[model samples]
Structures are given as C-alpha cells and as structure tokens.
Target: MSSRSLPTRQLATVLFTDVVDSTRQLAQSGDQVWARLLDALDAVSRSEVRRRGGELVKSTGDGALMLLPSPTAAIECATALHAAAGQLGVTLRIGAHTGEVERRGLDVAGMAVHVAARLMGSAGSGETVVSATVQALASPAAETYDDRGELSLKGVPVPVHAFAIRQASPPPVASAPLPVGDDRDAVTRLLRERRYEEAAEIAPEVDAATLAEALLAAGGRVEFLDVDITLVRMLQDVLDRLPADDAVTRSRTAAKLAFELRGDPSTAQDRRDLLDLATQLAESAGDAQAASEALLATVNSLWEPTGALDRLSAAERVITLTRRTNDVDHELEARLARLHALVEVWRIHDAGLELATYARLAARLDRPELNVFVASRRGMLAQISGRYDEQARQGEIAYTNAVAAGMPDAERLRMSHLFPIERDCGTGPDLFEAGLEMLRELTGIMPGNFYEADVAWVLLTLGRRDEARTELARALPPLLTSSGYRWLFSAVLAAETTAEVGSAEACQRLYDALLPHQDLLACVGPTFGGGVGERLGLLALRLGRTDEALERLARAVGDFDEIAALPWATRARVHLASALRSAGDIEGADSRLAEAKDTARALGMARMLAQIEAEDGGR
Candidate 1:
C-alpha cells in the first residue's frame, strides 16, 4: 500500500470520427476540393467538441480523436458532427468507448483510445458504433443503439460488444414514402384494432418501419386478442425486401417476429423457421449477440418431451456467444436459460455448480434486477435441500430487490416460487388461505390453465375434493401437449391430486406420462417438491399395485434422504407407510409412520402432521 502510487488514470469517453469514403471522394473531387472539405470538417469537429464539453485532442488528416467526460456527451458530439459533415457534403463513420484513460499532455493514451479507433474502423458509412461500455454508461434515451453484437476488430486484444448509434427518433421511411401523417396513422390504428383485412390492404404500401411498429403493437395484445397471420406475413415481406448484407437488421427483425409469434400455437412452425433464419443470418455475419438472442428465443419456446437436451445445447451456445459480446445482461440471461435447461433434464448437480459460477460473475455487475434472478435460483436449491430458512431468506432478498429495482413484473416473476415457500414454511397467514389468494393473483396476471393444477392441489389439501376434481379436469389437457417449462412440475401436482380422487384410467395416463422421466427431479423453475419416484409410487398405490408401490415409495424415501429435503422426506415416509400397510406389514408400517410423524412435528408441517394424526385415529 505504501509503495503504490496514486492512481493516475481517470475515466473518459474516447470518440473517433472519420469521413466516410474519403479516398473515393478525394479522387472524384480532386485534392483542392478534398483539402478544403477536410479543413471545414476539422473546424466543425473542434467546434462541436467544445459545444459538447469535450477536448478535440488532434486531427488525423481524415478524422479526429476527442475526449469527453461522459458517453452521453460523446454521443451528442458525434451526432452533431455527423450533421455538420452532412452540411459540408460529406458523411461520417464514428465510434466511442468509455473506459479508464491516461492523460498524455492534452492527449489520451490507453486501451480506451485504441478501442475507439478500432470501433470507428468497423463502423459502416454514415453510422456511429460504440463499445458495450459506452452503451451501458449512456442514458438509454440519448440515442438508439442497434446491437451489432460481438465483433473481432483487427487490432483489438479481445472481442468487443458493439452497437450502431442512431438519433432517438422514429425509423426513417423508405425513399418513396406511401402515406403520411393521418393516413399512415389510420392503417396503424386498424392493425391495432385487429382489422387484419383492412390493414393488409394498405400494408403492401407501408414502409418497413411502420409495418414493424404495427406488428409490435398488435403483438403486445396477445393475452386478450389474437395476432392475425396477415400482420405477420406483412412484416415478413418487409424483412425479405431488406438487402442481404444488412444482417443486423435482418437478424433483429426475424428474432422480433419469432418472439411475438410465440403465444400463437398456429405459428409454431413459423416461429421455428423465423428463429432459424435469425440465427443463421447473425452467425453468418459473425454477430454473436444477435445469434445469442435468437438461440435464447428458441430455448424459451421449447416444451416437447425430447427438447430438454436440445435446450441445454442451445443455451450453452447462447452463453458462449454472449460471453464473447461482453454484454453482462445478455450473458446473465443466457446462463439462467442454461440453468433452467439443466434442471429440466434432471442435471440438478450440474445446475447447482453452474449457478455458483453465475453468482460470482453477476456480483461484479452490481445490478439489483439481476440479483433478484440469482437469488431465486439459490432459493430453488434451498428448497430441494429442505433448507426452508435459507429458502425464505433468498425469497425475501429476491422480492425486496425486485421492488427496489422497480422491475415491472417483479410480483409476477417471483410469485410462483414464493408461493411454494410461503405454503411450506410461512409464519404470516393461514397457509391454505394465503396460498389460494396468491394462486388467484397469479392466474389473474398470467391466465390460462397455468395454475389450475396448483389450484387443484391446494383444494385437495383443504379437503375440497369436488372443487379439486373440477380444477384437475381443467388442468389435464395441457399435460398431453406443450405447456411450456412448468409442464413437469404441473404434472407432479396433478399426479398428487389424482392419487386421492382420480379414476384408474386417469391414474394410468398420468403414470404413463411420468414414468418415462422417472430419473429427473420433479421441479418447476426454482421450485422442487419431491422426486418423480414418489409421484409414481403414489399413482401406483392409487392403482392398487401394492408391490410396485412399495418398491417405488422405498426408493423415493432414499432419494429424499440423500438430498436432505426434510419436508419431502417426511412426506415420502408417510406415503411409504401407507404402501407398507397396504402390503400388510404392520410393524414396518407403524415404524415408518412413527419416523414421519416425528419429523413432521419438529418441522411444523401441519398438513402432513394432520394427515398422520388422521391415519392414526382411523387405526
């Protein structure tokens, strides 16, 4: 500490701007004309830099280097210079990077300066490109940055995540505009109103920007309204018209269309095709961030029984690509996707390990919104390990941090995970009442039969057999199709409900559905109830297969013990006792019951404890 010198480096935003196609312009206009233009551009650059609170370090004949205090200032100066160059009958290609730079006598020297030059070299004609750092530091409203993904600059030591900067305004219309003002607004309003035929009549005449806007507006009404195929086709047509070399625009458009189409079952194949195209375009252009986004969309739409392995593979690819981009936010999303896939395929141990690595990397970002996601995964692990205290703590951190971060979907995001913890170990409200309320709120927000199985289980726990049966009936159909990521856990809850009141046919159907994946843990995102073996055993018991029930239940007991999931272990023992009793082993039955009752009482598992007492009373 004593030997270390005071830090000489200070943070700065370094910017570079060069005349686009200067050589061609020089050859076409002669040296005198080009020289005069350069002089005027240099004067304009210096003036703009001073106006935006920056220092024009020096001119490089055809370009200039500048130092600014902030990314926003740098971008404003760049935008101003671009306009000024336009007046002088020239165009510009600009780049910016925000990082620590060493001041060198009215100049700057560091990786930041070098990286800015590299970025400028990568910029297309009339475009301003910035490193991910600059994009992150600048206000989002300062400019419109189209992510160009991870680019391999010629002299840069590492790949950089770059974005092309545009002014914060509506996308420019095509060279030949169709309708203007009120006329264009009419078509947009028609599209939003779901008048597909009327909108489609004018869609062919509309510009790409207008069509994209209408499509997004229509897509956002997915829950209450349906997206017309005509609208999708219109946007696709515009995307097709884009130049083949415009990979960034193409990839982004395709990805956006695919995402919006996800809620439409009829567009399953369309979504797949669009996502594939997006990935191909991005990859061919060496745009890692765009590729990562396309792959993430694919993984998010996965629901088929055989898709887990594919999902894991895709998620890993996304992580690799996003890491190259050096975009922490996207990388975090990719890693979380990978974590979910690992859990889905029953690689719980691997998921736990990866989560640890994810946590360490996320800590450096200091983003509370990201922290909420990390905490939720940790809570899931805690649930599996029967560490209810830790689970509750993590849940609180996630909820509080989500609120603190002003995450709009904070409640919806954490509700499903939090409900389970509250149901199992909360000291606040009556478990059943609070659980029912939370489920209702979640249903209101997400709608569908998404929570019907959960509702049925809660009802069954409350001894409302008739109501549980009704909800269970509503919940069964989605099990046969794609119910998204929560299918396995929903199946688990449905299986538990079926054990009590289901017909032999229903039990057999669920058994067939669950038996194929007996090796995987039955969990939904971060919520683990128990192993699949126990669920299978319970269904077997309901089907009167006592011998198979005994075998499966015994295995489930061992599984619970191995994981130290106290609540699940206790419940498994209770089920094992019933199986043993059915098999007519009185001593074995009583011993298992005694062990289960002890754990239930100590853990304050009132529902399970009541079940044990009820069984004892019947005996």
Candidate 2:
C-alpha cells in the first residue's frame, strides 16, 4: 500500500500474551516437546483472537501480539486464550490496552502496544491485566475488573492504572422471593442472622433507592458490632449492583464500605482508594455529609508522615464544608481527623488545640463511642508527650468506655495500644507475654500482618530473638501483598526484628525494601513513632554504618522532639549515643546519653533508665 493511502493511526485494543515460565518449560522439556507445546499454544491463541474479531499481528516465539476492534473484544479474547491455555496444561500472562495505535503494514507500534507488553509482564501466571483505558471502554464487562491500582510499568514514562479481570460469573437469577416485612428490616434480619448470601441475592430484587438505604443501614448496624467479613463483601456486591447513575448512593455506599474496610490489614490499600473515590463522588454530588465522612476516612487511612500534609488539607476541607452545611457530627469528625493528622506531622500544638475542641464537642454531643474515641486519641497523645501516668489513666478510661459501649474490636485495639506503654515503663515481662497471647488469639480470629508484626515486636523486646525472627517471617508475606501505613509499619517492625536475629544480608534485603519509603512517618504504637528515616538509622547501625547511623538518628531525634514525642525522641537519642560512643566521640556520646536518660527518667521508663545507667557505669 502507498504511504499516502495507509492508515497512520487508529483507535484499537492491543493484546499481549506470553507463556508463563517458558524457559523453565524449555529446560525441563526438551526442544522437541517445547516446540510441540508452543505450537499448540500458538494455535489456540490465534483461534481465540480470530473468534473475537482480533487480527494476529505477530508472534514472539512463545506468544503472539494481536489487535482487536474494541476493548471488550480484546478482553474476551484474552480470557478465552487463558482458559484455552489452561486446558492445554499451559499458563499464559496476558495484558490489554485501548488506545490509538500506529498501523505499520501488518505490524503495529505505539505507546499502547508498549503499555500492553509491560502490563503483560506484570501479570502473574494465568492472570490477565488491562489498563484503565481498556477497563473504561469495556462497559458492563468492566464490572468484572478488580482494581490492582497504579503500577510502575517498565519503560513507561508514568505509572499506569491497571485492573485484573476476574472470571465472569453468571448473572444472579432473582429466582428467590424477597423476604417478608420491611425491605430494610428484612435485609437487617438476614444480616443479623448471618445469611449474607441470601441477603445479597435478594438485595437486587428491591428498588435501587430501597437497596441503597438497606445496605447503608445494615452496614451501620454491623460496623462496630462485629467482624463480619462475609457481610461486608455481600453488602459491597449489592451496592455494586445498584444503579451507577446515582452518585449519592454510590458515594454513600463507597464511604460505608471504606469504613468497614478500615483497620483491616488485608484491605488497607483498598480502604484508602475507596475513601478517595468516595470523596470525589460525594463532592461531585454536592453531598457535604458524605464528602466529610469520606474525607475523615481518607485521613484515617493516611498513616504515613508523607501523607500528613494531604491528610491535614483534607481535614481542613472537611471542617469548612461541614460547618457550612451545619453538619455537627461531621464537623466533630473533621476536628478529630485534623487532630490526628496534626500529631502525625509533628504539629503538636495545633493537635492539642484540636484535641481540646474535639473533647468539648464529644461531651456536648454526649456520644459514648465518640467519648471513647477521643479518650483513645488523648491517651496516645499523652504517651507520645512523655506523660506516662496520664496515658495509663486515659487508656483505662478508653478501654472501659469501649467495652461498655460494646465495641467488638475494642479489646484487641486496647491490648495492642497498651503493650508498648508497658514495655516503655518496664512494667514486667508479663505484660509482653500477655500482649503476645492476646495477639496470637486475635490472629486466629482475624489474621493480619499488623498483629503478627506486633507479636514479633513483643518477642524481640523480650529477648526471644529467634522466636521474633520466626514471627517476622510469618508477617512478611502479607506485608508484601499490600501497600499502606499499616503495611509500612508492619514491614518496618519485621525488618527491625530481622536485624536483631537474622544475618546482615537478610537485614540488608529488608532495609532496601524500605529505602523508597524512608521519609514516610507513622505511629509505631501509642506514639508518633517509626519514621522511615528513624528505622533506616537503626538498620544502618545494625549494618555497622556508624557515621550514617549517627546522622540519621540525630535527624530522627530532632523530628521526634519537634513533634513532642518525648518517648520516641529519647529512644532516638539513645541510639545516637550508642553510635557516638562506638565512634570514640566521648563528649558527644555523653551529651546524647544524658539527654536520653533525663527524658527516660521523666517518662518513668525504668528499662531505658537502667540501660543508660549501666552504660554510664561501664564508662
């Protein structure tokens, strides 16, 4: 064809597929067998592409690239190819993207093709991944897309949003009749009865408005009352089935779902994204209450210091919007969110003021749950600020209120919160043992990386280095599966534990994984502790990088003190002092050690005080 007559660019869906572990298959099975298998795979892939109106552009030995008219066609073709390859005892990793592509004779070249190839490389064996553009164009089929979030594709200039397409299930048949009584009441009864599957099945039979109301009501009823993962999943499915055009319904449901997923280590990333999406939707819908709630949820999810500025910004917006709308509940929530973010960012004075305002609002509102939440925040603040006795006192009140108010997860939260306080106070080995036991039990009830890492931290503190290492190993798998403040905290704890018991090489691996996020700050326990930089300093010390350790620890100490985290500041000082002493800087070491000792004594930290005294005695 003449260049003038040829099509330079056209919108198309590009699909890339490759055999999983082709090298292994070739090495295990000789060239003869491999060639046969490759032939069979190529035949099946081409057949699927042809059936879906996709043109095979070229083959790359173990796989082929194809072009389809639409994203739906491309996705269907990829899914079919996956199933066909599975039947052939082969696994294929596939990726698809919808964008403008340059048609060069029989072959195609463009950003879309490169993106698809990178996405294919990202997919696991037998998995199909697609770019957000493809997902948006796939229409009803897009509902099957499970968001994998943004991924840094190799060779791509920017991060690409990707989704994994799950195998489609048959549409639910409304064969079952709706339960009797009020629609909301029926759904609530089913949820309370734990008939989640049945509730989900019947939810779509109700009108869209009624289903939205029932789902929101059911969500509120079970939110703090139980750990019902199945119920939450069912509710999400029901909400997904509701009319998408109703932004209010979508925003409310998303906010409610985000709340349900918050603090759940397995769903931390999801919670963050869902809250963000909810905020956007609510704002677009002009629903101030929903937007404020979503903003609060967003603030709760952002545990990293890097996120502190964004968290504060969102909180301030929430306050402004709620005040204008006269939403007292949301206004109080905004104040609490602002207080939390302020603390994370080391703006203690601002946090203290916000905390006082929050306390007054909670009192005036006379909400028991709100009172418990405020008390918990106060206890956390006091612990960080070197007020150990006040922390203990506030903690007791918070736990009491939590129990009295019937918060189902209250005991687990309380135990986790108090363990570090006890450790700092040298309250006894018994508290650590008790904390470990509680964590073990809680893990059985709801397994998570956070609980496992907490267990590892306690074990490390108790000097059971080997046991802590094992617990850290157990925690690593889940931490690798997600990204969020909780995951970062867990990963850091695991790294610290590993450094205590594992080889320098193993410690190096963990440290490298954390390097990218070193600037992120988060609460380690009841205090604003565990900045990425602080943990890096500890890792550096373990790796025998004394000068680097001293520098990083000094920075960490300054950061902690600025945030009014006296306990953490003392800990950082102690680390710095130890590094300084090792480097023969006697005067510098003495100054840091004296500062640490004084702070520890003020905080009533017996264990740290004893350690400092022993070091001084040795000198």
TM-score of every model versus the real structure? 0.61, 0.57
Give lDDT tens digits, candidate 2, residues 391-483.
Answer: 878788877865554333346547655766776787479878877787776555433325687678879988898898888777765554444
Error at 248, model 2, angstroms: 3.1
Residue 477, candidate 2: C-alpha displacement in angstroms: 2.9
Residue 271 in model 2: lDDT: 60
Relative to the true structure, candidate 1 reaches a TM of: 0.61
Cα lDDT for residue 360, model 1?
90
Most accurate candidate by TM-score: 1
True-vs-predicted CA distance for residue 245, candidate 2, Å = 7.3
lDDT of 1: 0.69
> What lDDT tens digits, residue by residue, belong to model 1 across residues 520-611?
67555456756777899999999999999999989888877875677888888989998888888888989999999998778766656778
Candidate 2 regions with alpha-carbon error over 4 angstroms? 1-281, 293-297, 300-306, 406-418, 524-530, 616-619
